[model samples]
Target: ANTVQVQVILDRSVPDRTALDIYSRPESGGDWTHHATAVLVSDGAEPGGARPSWPPRDADALDVDDVYEALTAAGLHYGPAFRGLRAAWRRGNELFAEVALPEDRHDEAGRFGIHPALLDAAVHLPAWAGLAEVPEGRNRLPFAWSGVRLHASGATHLRVHVVLGEAGSLSLQATDPSGTPVVSIDTLSARLVSSEQLKPAGRGVGDALFRVDWQPLELGPVNRESWAVLGDHGLAEALRGTGVSVSHYPDLTTLTGAVQAGEPTPDLIVLPITTHTGTEAGSGSQQAAQDPG
Candidate 1:
């Protein structure tokens, strides 16, 4: 018999906190086995605890200047959106790193609540571990993550600790300048892949296949007669020539209506208009039409 079962539930009654219990059983209606427990925790490190210490004592420094270059060589671009490596150090199997967003993005730190770029930089130290001998040309990328926790929010500068875990995995912890814990990750894994696999697929933006349904907006009685001529312009055929397969609906009001009426709602809902009669060059209508939304 394929006998395996697991159940998890949140424990209520804990004020401002959450606890989860996971249970497993070999067979149905058999005794339930308590497999594990998960609890919410916080580090409570002050806002600026990281700034004062200045790269903990006795740790060998790792070159921070060539961080992005090394990553790009390994097929990881470390693109501008996620570039935040400032400095790094290593002591034994433990690694410490400093990461900060560019000066212009400082104001967006709080709004984003622990930006992905900073978090990526924090885990990026391990890739720098064996810089000189990281194979000839294999690319590496993050494979998995587990037990991730965000204790607090808004950190422009961060201190990250990466410790060796079982089976070559890494455990990561990130803190703010004052040493206040911001996030903890139980496990982070990376996989090396061939450089050929890292290349981008040769698909252009226009090559995308999308189901689009045309709907006419309510233009009121004034434009109703004029809008009738707009619908017969063979707009769907023109869209087909541009590589989009669209379904035309002459009388659909809203996207939701198609779903409720057992019709396949298209990936895109296009509302056509005859003309912009009273709109100025820089008006909201022109701006909205220009936007790719």
Candidate 2:
């Protein structure tokens, strides 16, 4: 874990006929290991080249609905903002996908070169092709992205081609509708994890969207004679907090008569009752019913 070595050896010197031989080893005292060797070849309009026929000739269409349903059942649900995959198909180890963000998300994609949601959707195509090497009760989550290159930006719609690899790893190339490269990853690996591990913590019901604004109730200009209240310290303090005049009445009958007569009658009345938790207060709605008028 402390060190890594990567050596590239050129197999050929010719400009168009160059080849690369890669050797890698860990710093933890390991022998030199040959990783990958590639021969650089000119890409033409052919299979396995830079440009290929759309959708591949023999790819089988996958059931997009079933893929989502299965993922949701595994607790891998994608919200509206992240659901970008439109359709997908597979041929052999190759996966093809069509992905498009909602029109409203175009501006965000423009600012951030192919929205991460869309990019993530593109990578998930292999999972839809049943390429995930996850064990039972387990799901695969993205672990790393290597050799990633963003060639262009401002693409809301994309076509993705993926080559599934061993152990839940894959390589993907994405392009805009015009066949301009949007992004490409030489290697994308996913880590196997239990569904429980992927489950997010429960969110508060009213974090920001639902909130209580505790504004002082506006009852009005003070009318000392117009306010009659009967309760313990709790009710007295509540009314006094609003800057309203509070007159304590000994009996409910006297309070009721004064309120119904409508002359020198208190416009607001309060009656306090003890709560189960030993608090000396009833809810605002309950006190509202105790108003004499």
Candidate 3:
């Protein structure tokens, strides 16, 4: 989990000339298993690292569906369901594509941060675009990566771009709709294989579509369970660290009194955490504990 190194195989005769095998131990102290293997194609560059060769004379192409199938077949379950591909297109030797974000990826403040899983998924866009190549046949190999960056937050979409450079090197970039770059990869100095000519191990391709819902939490006194849940999940941490406070009122009568008295009640009010809980008037008791000031 700390670091990952992959192996790549290449064959000059095949159209798809790159393949990758990722190896990882089940646990920190557990045995190693061939986690996943994928095929890609490149004109004549190395697999991992930057500064391999340069702009390949020829371009390589690989099926998007095949790569997805290989990933799940290798026991790397993406999630509950795979959304369909968002978009795919080609420009010269370069390829571009997009994929949807998962639904369960929400942050504690009722907002979402860039999930690490999605970060891994974003890196695959370049390979899917045909900017790089994988090897052919049924082989489990490993690939190496250098730097990865998560620049944007609350991203609901992903985009990939790949450019072939001198000496068989490839430059890849991934971003979101706001044009915020998430990751950049330069792989030419590393070892790599091509697998564009091989038939996929399976016929079915995983879906790449997802539906997400964003709900804002009301900022008011909530029940013990709600307060604890929010705190444990991160809301409380954010409030405590930032010196923010939440106030709750028992009913509309008290709320109206405060409003008429020329006091701003609250920007938002969340109902009691429990269904059977009655209106407990004023600041309640938990609010004081949470915000002594």
Candidate 4:
């Protein structure tokens, strides 16, 4: 039957800890079988080490698109807002990355130290796990966690550090945009489970797992007579060929000032987004932008 039973074992000697086991039957008239056990502890969690430096100077910058493509090939799908892995780097046994929650997910950020989806992005960093050899085609689940501590809450963007453990585990630490500690995990253990365990006997485990929910965006055309762009000299020069008027501003602040002083305001504004692309300390950045209209 799909209905399962939960049993908890508590010790009077140690009231702060409890053991839990779940039992389910394979068929309507089958034997009751133990499915899972989890032990809950109310103590022993401690804050982790100091925050590491941001943008590791020696790590090789990884192609963010390549990283996501590899994960998708491995059957790990991420939705639009969930694809928050902006950039990544690797330096031997250590991995670092930049992650952010989309503006749409910011409303729910206060509900968690780090939104579950954002924390999940951190897990994908292990896709760069080249410091050691990994087994092939093994499906492992992280069922146990230890030394988890939350330093701060409501972070939208983070700089993450992941150190592969000597054994097959993960140690994670995350900080906010300004390098304030946000969360730390000492060790998260992943135990291998056989395919038989996943299928069980009667239950369709796939029904209980999560799937990518993709919402289609409704796009429409826009008509603008004037355009304003800042920071990118190349784009401004290109727009000069178009018959429409193009105004170039030195920066966003200057653009705002012209609009406030009764100067002509363009129908649409274009701004440049700076992104770090190299492992060097003072490397330059490339620009990306969406349709401003």
lDDT of each: 0.67, 0.71, 0.47, 0.71
After superposition of all CA atoms, the RMSD between model 2 and the true structure is 23.0
lDDT of 1 at 92: 91
Q: Residues 8-119, candidate 1: write the lDDT tens digits.
A: 9887567756787888755535556665676654445433323336586888998878777877777776667577887888889888898888878777778876887777
Candidate 3, superposed: residue stretches over 4 Å from native = 1-67, 70-85, 106-113, 125-135, 138-142, 165-169, 188-293
TM-score (C-alpha) between model 1 and the true structure: 0.51
* lDDT-better candidate, 1 vs 4: 4
lDDT of 2 by residue, 187-269 (tens): 98887777787754323422222445698987887535446667565676677789777777666787777667774556666
**Count of backbone clashes, every candidate in sequence:** 10, 1, 48, 0
Model 4, residue 137: distance off in Å is 4.5
Candidate no. 4 TM-score = 0.51
**Model 4, runs deviating above 4 Å:** 1-48, 128-141, 192-293
* Candidate 2 accuracy as TM-score: 0.51
TM-score of 3: 0.35
Q: Relative to the unseen true structure, what is the C-alpha lDDT of residue 251 in candidate 4, on a scale of 0 to 100? A: 81
- How do the predictions measure up, each by TM-score? 0.51, 0.51, 0.35, 0.51
Q: Give Cα distance to truth, residue 56, candidate 4, Å.
A: 1.5
Q: Could you give candidate 4's per-residue lDDT for residues 168-251 as a string of tens digits?
A: 588888888887888888897766544345543344443343446799999898665888889788898888887657899888
